[model samples]
Structures are given as structure tokens and as C-alpha cells.
Target: MTAVKVIKVVGTSEESWEAAAKEAVERASQSVEGVHGVEIDHWTAEIEDDEIVEYRATTEIAFPVQD
Candidate 1:
């Protein structure tokens, strides 16, 4: 049998929401191994002076557990 665990994380970027989502996984993978999949939970943005300044993404990362 295999064991899997999930973690919630947030990533922000000045580019796009897709990039933010990808960044979340990329940053998480730096500390987490055996990453299998990612689930995008939510998306939001920050606006400043009638312009969108930042993009944010919330994601859940799934990875395998080693015994």
C-alpha cells in the first residue's frame, strides 16, 4: 500500500494566475518530494490604482510518503 499526503499553500506572482499556481507547486517541491499532483483551490487578485498588481493562487499539493 501507498500513503499520500496533502498540503495547502499559496503563491503570488505579478504575471498570471496560472503562473502563480505553478509557482506554488514549484516552491513546494523545493521542500517536498514525490509530488504527484496539485489541486487549485481558489484564486484572487490585488488591485492598485485601477490596475491589477498581483495574482494569487491557493493550491493543495499531493505527495507520496516514504516508509
Candidate 2:
């Protein structure tokens, strides 16, 4: 049997929520191995004068642990 682990990470972007989510996974992959999937748990944004200035994403990264 294989063991898996999950970690929560948050990422921010000036562009869009999609970009923020992608960044969260990518950044986690840089420090973590066996990254298999990412689940977007939540989304938030900063508003500036009726415009969205920033986007943030809460993600859960799933990876396998080595034996």
C-alpha cells in the first residue's frame, strides 16, 4: 500500500484566480516531489476602486510519501 499526504497552500496573483491556483501548485512542486494533484478549496480577491487588483487561491496539494 502507498501513503499519501496533503498540504494546504495559498498563492496570489495580479492577473486572475486561475493563475493564482496554478501558481500554488507550481510553487509547491518546486519544493515537493511526487506531486500528483491539486484541489482548489477557496478563492478570494482584493478590490480596488471597483476593480479586482489581486487574486488569491487556497489549494490542497496531494503527493505520495516515499517508503
Candidate 3:
């Protein structure tokens, strides 16, 4: 039998939504092993001086269960 695990993580970047998503995956991979997939749940941004300052991404990271 095969098993998997998923966890939610939030990443932020001043660049773009894609960068934010990439940050989430990259940062998560640092601590979580066997990281294989990622799904973006939602996107948000911060405004400053009536302009977009930061991009945020909520993602679900998936990896195989370990025993």
C-alpha cells in the first residue's frame, strides 16, 4: 500500500504570485523530505500607497508518508 501526506503553508514575495508559490515549495522542501507536489489554494496581496507591495500564496504541499 502507498500513503501520502499533505500540509498547508503560506509564502510571501514582493515579486509575483508565481514567485510566492515557488517560495512556499522551496521553503517547505528545506524541512520536509520527499516533497513532490504543490497546489495553490488562494492568492492575496498587500497594498501600500495604493500600490501592490507584496504577493502571498497559500499552498498545499504533498509528499509520501514515511514510517
Ranking by TM-score: 3, 1, 2
> What is candidate 2's lDDT per residue for 1-67, written digit by digit as tens?
8899999999999999999999999999999999999999999999999999999999999999978
Clashing pairs in 2: none
lDDT of 1 by residue, 1-67 (tens): 8899999999999999999999999999999998989999999999999998999999999999978
Would you give me the overall lDDT of model 2?
A: 0.96
| lDDT agreement with native, every candidate | 0.95, 0.96, 0.96
Clashing pairs in 3: none
Off by over 4 Å in 3: none
Better of 1 and 2 by TM-score: 1
Using Cα atoms with residue i matched to residue i, what is each candidate's TM-score against the true structure?
Answer: 0.94, 0.93, 0.95
| Location of the lowest summed lDDT over 10 successive residues in candidate 1 | 58-67
Q: lDDT score, residue 55, model 3?
A: 97
